[model samples]
Target chain A: MSAPAKLPRWAELGLLPAVNLVAALLLSGVIIRLIGESPWAALKLLADGAFGSQEAVGYTLYYATNFIFTGLAVAVAYHAGLFNIGAEGQAYIGGLGTGLVCLWLGAWPFWVVLPLAILAGAVGGAAWAFIPGWLQARRGSHIVITTIMFNFIASAVMTWLLVNILIKPGQQSPESREFAANAFMPGLHTLLGKVGLAFTATPLNLAFLLALAASFLVWLLVWRTRWGYALRVAGQNPAAAVYAGILPPRVTIAAMLLSGALAGSLGLNELMGAQHRILLDFPGGAGFVGIAVALMGRNHPVGIFLAAVLFGALMQGGSQLSFDMPRVNRDMVVVIQGLVILFCGALENVARVPLAALLARLRGEKEAE
Target chain B: METYTLIVLLLAATIRVATPLLLAALAGLFSERSGVIALGLEGMMLGAAFAAAAASAVTGSVWLGLGAGIATAVALALLLAFAGVTHRGNQVVAGMAVNIMVAGLGPALALAWFNLGGQTPQLEGAGQRFLALTWPWADAARAAPFPGLLYAELLSGHNLVVYFAAALVPFSAWVLYRTRFGLRLRAVGENPSAVDTAGISVTRLRYQAVMISGVLCGVAGTYLSTAASAGFVRDMTAGKGYLALAALIFGKWRPYPTLGACLLFAFTDALATRLQGVALPLVGVIPVQFILALPYVLTVLLLAGFVGTAVAPKAIGAPYAKEK
Candidate 1:
């Protein structure tokens, strides 16, 4: 076989994303038209509904907050070469932990209760992720299989707990009791009102800032730390990492655990800051949506944040778009998401091959020197 | 005295419950052994179930519906194979795309085509109903001197698909272990490079394996809608496809052992259904959801514990790129 060529410049990597986005939007428009909806009108409605008012912006940010956390969770694992599909399950279990803590022990001051709940959520999420990680690392079991199985197990466990153990009396819904007053995350409405910027009630809270902070932290952790270097090495070339005296299994496990903890905190944010209680479908498809976000972001923290915001806007706007266009389902957002992932995957592959060939050619030149 | 009869009833339920899983797991064995991970089984089953119901409703022929179901599944498998093998897309992502697309598109299409979002019109007439067997010994067992063939009821008296599923276990084992085609397919999965050197097209072999899996998944879907429930419902397969996948892993990706794993989970589901209200011993105290979760929990635990060093087919998820 012929030797591969040299790497493509960074400009090429930058151009590919723009091309993918355009392709995705065009495809989505065609689909909308095929469904007999006015594509332009729908787009207009989407924009108007998502950002027309301060309240809408706040809601979009609130939704973005959850997506940011989950997206970062997924991105972190992807960087480590682990497909952490159990984020949904981990988020649910974490919600349960946060909910229980808030309900029982939230009488403490707000600062104390909030951090404790977040910690509990992270720990719960990490533990949930550790199961599949352990299996993958130690037994060489596939993460995909274990994580998928764990999703069902987690759902069943939550359903059982909701019905029998944690059911709030007289509320027949599959939900836990509301968190105590002190446990609730202070919404933007409260803080903004003090500064006279409040216009309407919006659930966006301190958690959004925390999610942003977490994204920066993840960037640093994945790029700056010695552990991060080991993870990257292990992911890119496991055999090489082993040769370098790194325990790949431990790195894999730690990466997955960290990924899960981030996802778990998404649930905590929703429960304590937005919903103020754990509902059966609280995590919903947000965890899966995070996968799309991570993919679109190319597994970068900043990219994930932007992608999450875009998705969050779509979701928030899509719901309102239903009022203007009654025939279009909110699930059209899912179609858009699917299109994005498809395009992104195709783009990534197309870019990688040429880049790898280019890198190989450069290496050959260096060897000749 | 009646508890003995109840135990017998439970045994009967186990076989009944095991049928679909047996079929689906067998289908998974064919695909995974061929080096393609058939994550689209759930989608295939769902699509088949929809097609089967629609065909049976229109043509009023159970056989026609079953054939349509299988055809739909094959079509989907072909699409997946084309994308994963020919287009060189990531198999897992492509499989997942198929799954999400089918999950969404099936319901929408069902609504558009049949106006049935969840439930289809129930099957009617002799053509629609499954054919059962009646033997003289079986009759004698139920008669005065004895009961009907105790074993026949336990095993034989179901639809033809049940026997077909049970038989496929051994047949698949033979195919995987003894056949030349099976050897080539296994070689393609284990080492596509080696297979390519032998002048066999890895793409063609993997495609064939995936198509076979689709056909089986189609049959499984037919059984689910027509034979099992006599009607179609949205998301009727539920997570059974995933369960079969789990069983495939739990069985360490082998044929016969996978069948056994599927049966074990099916037995638990059947037992859960049977013991829902009856005042039994410790088992009865378990909630239905816990029992429902047992299979998944077992799969995780087994993966974490017993399945040390689970080795997938070497080229399982990699898209085969011929030398340029």
Candidate 2:
């Protein structure tokens, strides 16, 4: 066996996030240069578009609301060593549930309808994910293959439901009718203005506050709860966890269910707060972006929240960038996100080797001599 | 039609449906057998489709287009192998990166190269298409009512690569079970350290397997763009490569069973397409999405219920490193 070396405190606690941010910026800069755009100009445009005005800040926060939930979903599963790749499908199912509830209970008050709709969404999301989770936990099937396959199945099912069943007749698009006014989240634009705190025209809502609350709850569960500790232990070493009498299959299943529920909450927020109806591609790419967020954050809740905000800014700014730099496609944002995930995942393995720390100590000793 | 005719028709549909999947599954077999999990097969197929369309448009030779597709896939496989085998990078992460890169790059390049947006210019005339095969005896059997070109066309009349895909089943089975090189390949997947100690180079063997997978994926991509369809469209392969990987697992990593799994999925897809117009009682009310979802739902069910004890090759996704 190899000797166990003491890890430096800073490397273990702080260096990773800083390194990821630096790597993300460098890669984004390189991508900008490759596309023949000036990096400084792009950065300035992004800053202005994301936070230049109170309206911009509100919009960024609005986008961050959905991402925050999805990021937590991914982090929860990662902590249990279950890669929940079916978040996209689960989110779709959640949106469907939210829509159906709104249609059925359109006369209900906002106080009652909203909570019931969100709960229904969570249940739908959990049910959608349970199939793959049960398969993996009970039969030892690979979660990756099952979840990937489920995404396609869910897409087809959702499309069919939208077109044939849920669609209001004569509408060609895959979408439902407008949601009841009671189902809508109270927009912060009017409320904040009434309170003399409004500085923007954007419509932030209760979902943003819920997103922050969800992140804090996740942080608490992961760092303090016994179940979370067991999940982490199982993730870190399944064989050892099994030896210690922890049922890995059960933990994996629970983690995946929770992940799906969180993803479902994102769909609820989008349906009730932003769009007020289910539309095709409503939660577009947020599920996939959550993967990058989880990776960039090193699967930590606080880290995922920060990463989600960064991406939310990029996405919100990317739309404005289209108007300013008409030649550059907004897809450059996707490329940047992909590069960050790639580098961050790769860096995780490299960082554990202590080569950088060893070199730093050696240089300091040489200087002393 | 009589029961015999119905049976024959079903058999024919199965073979035709299985062709692309069979080719892709064979590709998966090669990569996984070499201890590398190729999650990038979807990306490789997409790249090959684009390249084949561009080459065929420029050269006016379908054969040249086929070659271009294979070459492109092989180049991608080399990249995957380099990161996975040589640099000892995380195989899944590298594979995913390659996929994202291709998804982004393919459309961007198509826009720049073809100027047709996300599609290629369609090919014209029978000269650029695959010809069907016919049999004299089958034609003469009116009592038996054997399908003339239909029988041979379903089984053998495919483009050269379709035949190659069928041949790969028996050929791969033979190579894997009978050959010395196959033994070393299996050894490397099962125990790289043991193989390294036994004087075999793990890197070289793995590189060869991954390259072979690349070539096969390239052929599959060409078949999609040129043989199956007249032109390439954006994201034409969709998720077929991933489905083939699922088939690989469903087949329990065996050649024959994997081919069977491919046929099963393809048959369901063909059935779904054929059922689009029919309105048969209560089931007719079922949405097209339900039918389309059949294959994947069945795959999940089968994996969860029936294939209870499948085992992957040892060290399947682990990158091999030399000891200091």
- DockQ of all models, two decimals each: 0.36, 0.37
TM-score, B chain, candidate 2?
A: 0.90
Per-residue lDDT of candidate 2, residues B249-314 (tens digit): 778778999998898888777767657767877765445667767778767876776745567789
lDDT of 1 by residue, B104-135 (tens): 55554454455554357778865874556554
TM-score for all models, in order of appearance: 0.89, 0.88
Residue A84, model 1: lDDT of 79
Looking at candidate 2 chain B, the ten consecutive residues that score lowest on lDDT are B129-138
* Best candidate according to TM-score: 1
Q: Lowest-scoring 10 consecutive residues by lDDT in candidate 2 chain A?
A: A1-10
lDDT of 1 by residue, A246-333 (tens): 9999998999999889988986669988888778868977787787788778788877888888888988998998778755656567
Per-residue alpha-carbon lDDT of candidate 2 for residues A72-177, written as tens digits (9 for 90 to 100) = 8888988888777778888888778887888888779888987888788888888888888888898877787788888888789888778777787788887888
- State candidate 2's DockQ: 0.37
Which residue ranges in model 2 land beyond 4 Å of their true spot? A1-56, A199-204, A243-245, A323-327, A346-363, A366-369, B1-17, B58-64, B86-89, B121-145, B155-157, B281-286, B321-324
